[model samples]
Target: MATTASTTAPVSLASVTLEVADPEAAAVFHRAFGVDAYVGLRAAEDAPADGFRGFTLALTVSGPATVDGFVGAAVDAGATVLKPATKSMWGYGGVVRAPDGTIWKIATSAKKDTGPATREIDEFVLLLGVEDVKATKQFYVERGMAVAKSFGGKYAEFAPGTGSVKLALYKRRGLAKDLGVADDGTGAHRIVLGGTGASFTDPDGFVWEGEK
Candidate 1:
């Protein structure tokens, strides 16, 4: 593995293919946002495993109207609302989970003046709640991803590639608690990541596939 320095690697998420039980249904809900859904037996499985840990999809759009529109569309398509859209530290947005068991955060930066949304999902981030942020960040760094920003062992953020999704690391317990879920996330992550040196699962159990 070729580990990059703290801010040197060019690693970024290319796509997030979620393993879902019903690709058809999941697609119907996620289609608007460009989320690829496949039967993973997360697509083929009959039920969510005990302590099923879910990941959050950060949908960074243009502004409030776009945020409300997109997130509302998801809810209409069968997504459960985890948080209503509102102004937050990050921006104006909310959270929801599609029927396929994928959670999403629909948000926008308040400082942005980017008009309306250009795509259903402008920016995509796969936020993993890890047991140890330091170790996890190091694991990725060793695998060639450079750290864009980090707060010691608490949280770490990666910058986007030319056209890649962002990746971030946070403490598992704190993240789960923020999402109002159990820290012991079980079951498959049902996520597919591209644009890495190789394919492997992190210590926290989330799996990744390689693209570059």
Candidate 2:
């Protein structure tokens, strides 16, 4: 028999969630997810803000020029470029930060995937850095996403539910050490849309926006 993920899970992300103190203001800065869930705001008492350390949202457009346009739009929206748009083995791409401070990566394939003429985000990936992949994986499991693939305690990938962006969990220190950075990510998850109802918080403090 073919296997399937659990359906009893309550949290179902409509799109990616982004918690903001002022949803109206935030609405102007970032645009990626099919849905953007919010908790309250970046300054909510329980969740404090900090430099983006743990997770990143990737937007893979269709081509190089399109990549450049997206990067430019980010900068116009108050993003600080971490890297300029350029062609490489990973195709043409660049990195930038939304005004709200979320790290955004825009890229395309190196070869034929330069993208079609229309240029649009064809793929999306959400990477969450956690203290323990197994534990975090279980947390999200309890929420909704199914474990599409995993690597012991090192990494775990969750299949996308109704949304296009796939979720993945990785060890905080492992990834930080790999990037030569310290694991200083805080609970102030500016966005955390997944699940079915009102906003909620996971064990690691990642927030999830619920259905209205």
Candidate 3:
């Protein structure tokens, strides 16, 4: 008689669940750079239980913190803490509510194949919102982001170098349409400055700058 052997595949992270009141606004924030809004509402709604379709989750954290600390910070950041942070059965964990009202579970370790937890010290990406794409592209070119590609004359992508994160300039309305979300008419301008090891949004309503 022949016998069958069973095996299970390793699990991994695919995408960070960003719960925002407006998915379109979040999409605009990301598209200002070059993130493709590949998945829409139906997909996003389904991904959590599906363990993410398969991209490589990139999450943001303020810093190392215990369950209480995490919860406190989340609450103070203009967000409600839906679930009080608590230890999970799994070794590394905590949970909190994001500004957009999405529940985010904090974990110290992810499956090995999920990819690095953070960018290198000198590397980072800036996702900004822009009113006009063409003008922004010209502005970045002057600021030193070499245009790498243009998408149908609406979105412009730039890869400055390994030391700096890639950048994208996108039209807000078009970006929202492409992402299948409602556009929040914030229309804020930001100038991202590279090489400072820090990022700041200008108070003049002119620009937001991100640096190494």
Better of 1 and 3 by lDDT: 1
True lDDT of residue 206, candidate 2? 67
Give lDDT tens digits, candidate 3, residues 87-164. Answer: 334334444434433333434332222333332122223333356677666655554447778875477767645432
> For residues 157-197, could you state the per-residue lDDT of candidate 1 as single tens digits?
88775445688888878777766566675666667666544
TM per model? 0.80, 0.71, 0.35
**Best of the two (2, 3) by TM-score:** 2
**What is the model-wide C-alpha lDDT for candidate 3?**
0.37
Q: Least accurate stretch of 10 residues (summed lDDT) in model 3?
A: 49-58
RMSD in angstroms between candidate 1 and the native structure over all alpha carbons? 4.7
Q: Which candidate gets the maximum lDDT versus the true structure?
A: 1
On lDDT, the stronger of 2 and 3 is 2
lDDT of 2 at 82: 77
Model 3 Cα shift for residue 112 (angstroms): 20
- Candidate 1 global TM-score: 0.80
Q: After superposition, how far is residue 113 of candidate 3 from its true place, in Å?
A: 13
Writing each residue's lDDT as its tens digit, candidate 2 over 26-63 gives 66564432214322234334557775458777777777
Measured over all alpha carbons after superposition, the RMSD of each candidate to the real structure, in angstroms, is 4.7, 5.9, 19.2
Better of 1 and 3 by TM-score: 1
Stretches > 4 Å off in candidate 3: 1-127, 162-164, 187-212
